[model samples]
Target: MAFDNFYYCVLYEKKYSDYFLYQCILLWMCRKTKSSVTEQQPDSSAIHTISTLPDTNQYLYDFLKMVLADQKLQYSYGLSQEVKNCLYVESDEVYLSRFIITPPQTNPYDQNPSGVDSTKLIYNTDSSVSVNISAQLILNTLTLLPNHACLKKSDITYMMAEKSRLHNLKWNNQKTGFSLTNKNNWYTFSLPYFSKDKKKAFICIQSLCPGLCGSGDVLLYQFKNNKWTSQKVDSWLH
Candidate 1:
């Protein structure tokens, strides 16, 4: 006698022997249902397994490496070498990582340096989400073009006059000076002294005109393959 459904069980329940068989079948069905439910349920440990944040210093180091590897900026700045001995990590907030780049000491015996470079990390609080890393050149007196003999006032004036002509603008003859000033004048200088290799040079112009036209610009000229090729970098001044 086969009991496939509840109706079958009821129909078969007649004699004592049949009643005993139906009772056994009900017990088996109950056990099978319990087993199936248990199999479908997820394990609590597996579901609640916790993830953690990466080591801060290591993460920032990796980030800096990637930034230095950028083809365009690396060719001009050589950030990889500059940052090798100077990278540091700290927390600005619970969710933000700060990478600080300290300048190399001027003197071997000096224990402290005055300049500091910093970049902030922006990321989601959720561990499962991706993180965004970014950095920028922090301009300062140390980062600016250093004084060079080639950056004479007369040379600056000629360069500015040529640049003005190309742009269909007038060169501010009165504003030509070595030091940066607030007046709407032209300040031209060369930073050949800053290049460790001595084969690259930077020329900067600061113009404070009456309107938005007044701004600072830099040009990087690298002596490569027996010729000088010029590249424009982002302005150090706003």
Candidate 2:
């Protein structure tokens, strides 16, 4: 579901290189479309999806090992590992998430992207963290991080709409579907009765390019009755 009717352009942030600051802008704007707001009937027409994640999966901790490959290297030295420290998720919930199959894109020989290649940064009322991933599957690619891993206040966490005046990236309330005064993300989605909102209850993987395999991360949050909650966990997968 691509938009032939799409708007594309560039912005000069002056503070950072065009690629550094604008990558998020590009993702936010050209982000892929969702399956039809209405679902196709599973029928004589055979409307259904059977999903699976690749065996070479690298949840955040596995990614950390890759980043700090040398025995002497510490996790803090790796940019992505540092990013993961900020996003906090439940250990039991860390598993590959399957996504609807979309056409594959032309990746270069040097660019063996694995999962979600986009970086996900989570923000709360008083804290923020970022989840960086490297997955090949459309969905089985993201994980969570903790607030302590957020590192700097100026890191590429909260993205500002290219032309917005406010610092926050305002989005709607996933639960009520109403306009939310507060901005949030972590790829809000659902599971039965759970609201795996980015504000510590959801996760996603967006990229999987090799070297730094284009990656993605899920910023899950726990919002009860409109108030965000806090939590934590630690581990890895490969």
Candidate 3:
């Protein structure tokens, strides 16, 4: 008999025009299995779960190769290599893959870099395949300076709210967040040594914008005399 179902998870990171965009897509073949019992009666024996299936890494790799063969994407070499590196199979019949693309050269005087055209292709398995795609900005890792400490989550939330208010930017206290992992949109904050006495320190907040294509920001703050004060710092976006 044919395979009952299939699941695919695709993730990729691309840097273009000084913006890093990461995307994840989950695809599944959605169909009900035929059972010997009547439609009105449930058949427990006919039900099969993903965990019962064997490892599907080879199948997923083959599928990806076939899918990429039909597409006309710029940087196909780099993307295909990355895809090969990221493809893996999970225990739950899930295929997860991620890849990153870096530009070959960044010289304004030289030739203009080739831009990748977006291509969409329909993948066929046993029946019809369902696709779901999610994209987010890439979060960079920040190494804390010596004698530095990270601010508490509550403090960061409050600081972000005040900053948004003063800067006239729309921010939600509940949604504005931070994380050790770069899965979602959040800012990670650390306090660097600011004074010789080490009592006062500069708050360094690093974050990526919410959308797929946006710049990252590093906000600095100083705590003195029982008040938190913002400070100006030179930041570069690339």
Candidate 4:
């Protein structure tokens, strides 16, 4: 029998008086509404989403490999070969604000003690090397990246995964190495922001491991004679 009908019949019985009948009606309505709602709702876990990464940019990979191969970057981590091989590159590109700087504009209301020109923007954090790319263009691209950009697995030659995977590793007694069973440590690189002429590139690379093992720096690379050479523009270590 329908619950509503059952309640109606109970309410008709004189012995099944006021409060009991009212409670039964309320309980039946709640049960019916709950069941109907459950049947109508979708199973969120069953729904899957496929996120597509950006196209493979040869220069981006080239720059990454070049920096990774740097002797300083390799040995500075103080990790053994086993742990170094476990270094996984992040699948999404990032921009490190601490390393890239926009020089103060020449607006009259703004501080202009040095009289820096607004047009002279896009400098390295130390304000020593000024890149040829428009400051606004780079800023807009970097700002939009959180919502729109990602690196594809095929775009990288190294092992690539999300940074969160670092938590899966089992640290060794010294914390400088991971146990043989652990999957990886992690490193990240900013997209290679190139000069308009494509001959100059600026990038930031960060290496992170469990505990105090880490190093990071922003570098400026100049392409010349069909080869790329880099200079440190900013640095951090631990």
Candidate 5:
């Protein structure tokens, strides 16, 4: 019931009585609570199976191989670290809008800054060559993407879903108390946001190990001459 109607019932109406008012108030409260929960939940489209998209399956397969072999990443591994063996990947697809770069638009003088690298994913650096992929297009969940089964090409363990991954982490924490990295390292991947023509795409991959071992990167991949070339758009480490 509307607030105004509730007030009218309280201040003016007497035939319907306090029981009716209480019922109306309870329904309103229940609706408000439900709406709040819905807003806090993640996008439902992100939790579907990716087996339907054959091309996306192959693309992810190739991209993962490229990432694992990256020399720079291999060098970052400490004596106790490794990417192969018991690696656990998240089963759902994530969206890239969280990692989008948003620059200040108040400065007129800074509008046309020179020396900006076009190859990089700098937002508002140069309008002509700017990476202007649409949010709607990139958020397409229909793109046959990667899942636990598709990621089986690698010699690693893939968690069935986020719930399973979290349960394992919690069980490990209780058993070893964050002191051991054994089977605790995990990786999460975002569904690749493709450009309008499907020749370019952006994806985010995050890895978390026990203690201070963790890192994430937003990568840009361009398909050229039947091969995909990747470059770093942004990254973080801990």
Candidate 6:
């Protein structure tokens, strides 16, 4: 309910009906008060002194972090609850920023990307994903790409996706090899070991990518003679 309140606040803001909003908040507060009293055993004064007035969204989230610092919060964890609610509000705001209001776009390729020496996890011997992370030079954007010509025959870096569901990898870890395949009709990175018959690994170039443009292909370097043969393998990527 608290999270719902945050979402409503961010998305509708001035549009929300005052009565409806107040009711929702009042209901949420009642639920929280009951839960805190039973679980935390706080004195009656703690409950009575607490205020339900709306506050700055960021403050709500920060307050949550402080409450969570301690292991216990069964009674009055308003600060912690508010922080979680803040995150939810932020996510909603981002989604709205992208979908409902599409602003003028920036050319992601124009910016300087992560370091050339930086290496990222492309696959982890698993089948769920294959990605390259960059960030030798931090940009305002989460990800970036280099130019197409650079992508044609160069290496690039991209900041890995932030911590998330459906995402796995030790964040900012050095380059770990990866593979991608359609397993059970689902695209997956990381191939099983000892499956010599399967595509083993996936690689990418992040030179000109503005974050992760998904340009270029996997690294398919094979040595036939004294010379090395490097091929672009994006299609071969998942």
* CA deviation > 4 Å runs, candidate 6: 1-167, 171-201, 208-214, 223-228, 234-238
Per model, how many backbone clashes are there? Answer: 1, 46, 0, 0, 1, 37
In model 3, which residue pairs have backbone atoms overlapping below 3 Å?
none
CA error at residue 49 for candidate 1, angstroms: 2.8
Q: Candidate 3: misplaced stretches above 4 Å?
A: 1-184, 209-220
Error of 4 at 139 (Å): 35
The models' CA-based lDDT, in order, is: 0.39, 0.31, 0.31, 0.50, 0.48, 0.32
Question: Model 4: what TM-score?
Answer: 0.32
TM-score of 2: 0.16
Q: Relative to the unseen true structure, what is the C-alpha lDDT of residue 151 in candidate 2, on a scale of 0 to 100?
A: 18
User: How displaced is residue 2 in candidate 6, in Å?
Assistant: 92
How high is the lDDT of residue 39 in model 4? 87
lDDT of 1 by residue, 142-175 (tens): 6364332233333334443433333432222222
lDDT of 4 at 113: 50
Cα lDDT tens digits for candidate 4, 82-118 = 2222111332233322223345444453334543434
Which 10 consecutive residues of model 1 have the lowest summed lDDT? 78-87
Per-prediction TM-score to the true structure, in the order listed = 0.22, 0.16, 0.20, 0.32, 0.31, 0.16
What is the Cα-based TM-score of model 6? 0.16
In model 6, how large is the Cα lDDT of residue 44? 77
lDDT of 4 at 1: 64
What's model 4's lDDT at 231? Answer: 74
Task: Estimate, for each residue in 18-37, the C-alpha lDDT of model 5 and write its tens digit.
Answer: 66988999999999999999
Best model number under lDDT: 4
